[model samples]
Target: MSWSDRRHLLRVLVPGLLAASLSGCGFQPMLAPGSPGAALSGRVLVDAPTDRAAFDLVDRLEQRLGRAETPAYRLSYSINLREQGLGVTPEGATTRYNLDGSITYALREIGGDAIVASGRVESFTSWSATGSTLSTLGAEEDARQRLMQILADQIVTRLLAAAP
Candidate 1:
């Protein structure tokens, strides 16, 4: 091939390579299956210290976790999900019109002060406004949902970390 042809080929090939390389990322949005909530029945538990978080956790777990599983293998350890707050903030100066608080939680399989699978995540919920970009309750919900999934994974990591 001529030098010009080789240059042209490289130009075309580079973009194709770039596109393919960028296409495959683990990040993806999950599609819901008719329902809007989930239940717990397997090894995971959302037993909160307070009633409010417990109820909220229940809804979130059901909403995000999908459904409960009455598994045969009893989980050797129990992981707890606790929250720090239940609200969202826009920037820092301005607050949402709706209620705005914070929620922080961790997954810990407590035995001799041992943290099994644990992580801390936060979310924001607000009825700031329809056109208002700040305090988007929808975005807060999304963050909260994903945080639970991450917590589940952290639990697995803790399990593996404890393994001999």
Candidate 2:
């Protein structure tokens, strides 16, 4: 076979081979029916938000895990955030800032006190401060929102991995 024909054949054959191997190994999507993720979906009740940051986190968690109507598990989390200057101008003015965030979460059976899964996830986002006061404030808020989303995604991934 010519080089072009061989290349085209390989492109199709490789994916078919990969799919066959994956199925033979019992590989299935995490969110597929009867999977751990499917079992946990819409079954976790996240703690109520107490502030804007908490609200963002809860919103994302709900978006990922679905809102529980009859909850089997309760997820409680605490968000800790810190801001540090990352870039400085020649005159010692802060030009960029980093928002470091961490969430400590625990999942427990709704009516029981024993913890089922617990973990802490950390992430960071940055925003530019070299702008007008209003623009700087907006950038900082955007960074905070992104940080919360990152932390929430981590929480959901961990919960899915730990689901029974």
Model 2 lDDT per residue over 65-97, tens place? 999987999999999999999898899999999
* Model 1 C-alpha lDDT per residue in residues 1-164, reported as the tens digit of each score: 99999999999999988777766763222232321111122324445424543344455554443343542122222334333333345654433333323334344442443444343433333333334455465655554455444544444444333321
TM-score of each: 0.33, 0.96
Clashes of 1: 11
C-alpha lDDT of candidate 2 relative to the true structure: 0.94
Q: Over 4 Å off in model 1, which ranges?
A: 1-41, 66-98, 110-113, 128-164
